[model samples]
Target: MLRIRGTIGDLPVDLTLELDDGDWARLGSQLQPAPMADAPAAAVAPVKQRDDLWQSAQDLLRNAGQLSGLELLDQLEGLAGDASAAKRLLVRLRHSPKVNVASGGDTPLYSWISD
Candidate 1:
């Protein structure tokens, strides 16, 4: 069993994933580190083009396909600005147990185990 710590929705949780070495290897193959902005590039992120964080984040995240939870959040935070509302929205999205993934499937997405 491999225990990984990640943030899902709104709460912090420790996920104990039972995986054999082969399974772990397969998962490792699917994961990719996010591209980091170089020097002269701001690290915080940028405001998203769309107003709806849910829709925008979903599309970007899905397209980005295989990324660690931290990478996914880096992209999401890039879309959020310094607005108080935006911060609140991020909090809500991070902590929520279930989110609408827009596939007509209201599944539990985004686990925010990182406070």
Candidate 2:
């Protein structure tokens, strides 16, 4: 027996399914693991793009020398095309050895300190 209880678009839903031994055997057979295939090129492309974006972000900070958190976020958001992506890049920058983060009263100041 399988049971599911959830809400769909604010509507409550409950479902139950009962299966015999033969049915369960067939389902189990269908669920058997398949052989893994090589990863597709599309899957690898995003990683490269992310690396490029990271490099661009570093370059942006390097050129600017220093900027407030809000200011950096604005430029990164534009470069990344998403607020979440920008924030992620900001966090990555915070951890990078080439960048330094200092508290600037109301916001953090990001400065590029190349080694």
Candidate 3:
């Protein structure tokens, strides 16, 4: 038995398959990859595990058709200029980030002050 659920293009969907060899032959290219013994180890981490969260968040926001990046900043600017809330959000984002210095605040935010 195989269970799959997610979006296809702009449409959301779900599917389940219970198959024997003959049934699988019908699926051909559509059949998903076989599960391996290491599948448990491949389980994703939570929000604090930045990589997983970043991709997951992007996907969720994209699915919801929300504005990203520059727009996200513009929305936050409503709260304050150089806002403590924005800085705190960025700090937490950077601390558990997918890459080093994911946001401008990591260095450039402090550049003028230091120089």
**lDDT tens digits, residues 1-115, model 1?**
9788977898898988788999988888789565555433344433433446666655564565434444555666677644554445555555544333222234324432322
Each candidate: what lDDT?
Answer: 0.54, 0.95, 0.46
Q: Please identify which of the two predictions, 1 or 2, would achieve the higher TM-score against the true structure.
A: 2
Range of the 10 consecutive residues with the lowest summed lDDT in candidate 3: 106-115
- List per-candidate RMSD values in Å: 21.3, 4.5, 15.9
What are the TM-scores, per candidate, against the unseen true structure? Answer: 0.29, 0.68, 0.22
Off by over 4 Å in 2: 1-37
lDDT, residue 75, model 2: 99
TM-score, cand. 1: 0.29
Q: In model 1, how many backbone clashes occur?
A: 14
lDDT of 3 by residue, 1-115 (tens): 7889999999988899789997777788567665655455436333235454344443433343433344444434443345554445444434532323324543322111111
- Backbone clashes, each candidate: 14, 0, 0
Best by lDDT, which number?
2
Residue 81 miss distance in model 1 (angstroms): 1.9
Question: What's the lDDT for residue 113 in model 3?
Answer: 12
